[model samples]
Target: MKRSKLKWYGAKSELIELTKALIENGNLKGKQEDIFNEIQEVFNIELNNIDQAITKFNTRNQENETKFLDTLKNTLSKYIKSKLEKNR
Candidate 1:
């Protein structure tokens, strides 16, 4: 099947974190670079210097390190709550 190329405009760190999480959780197989290449092909985005980006993400202050993941959690929580309320 042909895949459409969707551009990713978010921070590279966020994408890197997500990629690592997928691998760590056993949701995806292969090395980081391989996964990154797949993502790039699928999304038509360029992800360069992944190792360096990950290093920067790790060194960030506690509050900023997982900002994107935290945002996702909060957004999903709100969506679930809204759905539950609507079902009442």
Candidate 2:
């Protein structure tokens, strides 16, 4: 499948915020203890410049989305991909 190249500014920031909310609200279900940390690791890159940050976030989000979809079960992956489609 061909991946779309549209970019969303502050998506990493949005991801971090949503992940934080899920953790704080205990909204994530079973085996989610380290999931936020995993997302954090993806956000930890040193984007010293604004352009760098934007580029890095876009690149990482694309990579992470690919991996996330690959790991999801058949029934759930489409749901996730659907949510992502709105942002693009």
lDDT of each: 0.83, 0.50
Give per-residue CA lDDT, model 2, range 26-84, as digits (tens): 87755544665454445553222333433444577655643433443554878889989
Q: Point out where model 1 deviates above 4 Å.
A: 1-3
- lDDT per residue as tens, model 1, 1-88: 6875687788777888888778879999987778899988877778888889888877989998877888999999999999999999
lDDT of 1 at 25: 92
Q: What lDDT would candidate 1 get against the real structure?
A: 0.83
Q: Which model scores highest in lDDT? A: 1
Which pairs clash in model 2? none
Number of backbone-clashing residue pairs for each candidate, in the order shown: 0, 0
Q: TM-score of predicted model 2?
A: 0.27
